[model samples]
Target: MDLYRSGDHYVLHADLPGVDPGSVEVSVEGGILTVKAQRSERTEHDVQWLASERFAGGYMRQLSLGDGIDSEHIAATYQNGVLTVTLPVVEKAKPRRIEITPGASEERKIIEPADAPEQANKT
Candidate 1:
């Protein structure tokens, strides 16, 4: 499984060849995302084929997700034997704006609190 991010969206791409869309199941539970694909056996008959690179089997892969992902809002798409899962991250997880306040120009002061104990005084 390949993981990536674009803006507020996180993407997961899995390569599942010869697997039907119905057989593929994707879900996120307890902050962990899993992709499972089950393939059915195809009875082969005596036939001549020039070349075949595809294998005949099922595939399953799981990935541990972080807390930034939105577990409820997840979408998946299967195209050309590639399963692409898209998950939107939480609003707080995305980059946020930090309000900058302008202050009056004054001389810089480096002074500790009077009541606070000094570090040098400690053993």
Candidate 2:
């Protein structure tokens, strides 16, 4: 599985060849993200098995997601033997640019607090 951050959300990709799309499951609980999948093997008794090397069983993976993740909006999709999961970060977790207004750095520019007038009267 490969995971990477794209913009405000994180994308996860896992390969599950020959696995049924309906068998894939994804859930998040208590800040933990879990993914489960299953692939069934051929159980025909009449066929003679020559060689069977492919994996066939349940697949489960759990990841400890931090508090920043928005678990309520988590989404997943399976297509062409690939499972894709998207985890979006909360609004507070997203990066915000702090605007640096033209402060008192220049003599022509003056920065005053909202309570500046009240403080002056008290002085």
Candidate 3:
């Protein structure tokens, strides 16, 4: 499985060759993401097999999703024997520039010490 960030969201890719697409299940419970699938090989009666080295059975994987992840918007898809999961980050977690408002210094007020009455009156 390969997981990496792409733009505003993170993507996870897993290879599941020969696995039935209908058997693939993606779910998020609490803060964990889980992937489940099954692979079944063809069988024939009264046949001899030269070699068989393919995995066939129930397969499952789980990932812990920390804070800032928008779990509600998370989505998954299976295509070409590959499973892709998209994890979107919340707006507060993304980096953004804060716009500075101008004219703050223009509204400054001059203050003089109480003991310096001459300077206060001059201003």
Deviation (Å) of 13 in candidate 3: 0.5
How many pairs of residues in model 2 come into backbone collision? Answer: 0
Q: TM-score each candidate.
A: 0.71, 0.76, 0.76
lDDT tens readout by residue for model 3, 1-123: 999998889999999999999999999999999999999867777989898788989899999999878999999999999999999998888989999887756776666677589776788
* Candidate with more favorable, higher lDDT: 1 or 3: 3
Model 2: ten consecutive residues of lowest lDDT? 102-111
lDDT of 2 by residue, 1-123 (tens): 999999999999999899998999998888999999999987879888899898999999999999889999999999999999999989999999998888666668464898788878998
- Which of candidates 1 and 2 reaches a greater lDDT? 2
Error of 2 at 38 (Å): 1.0
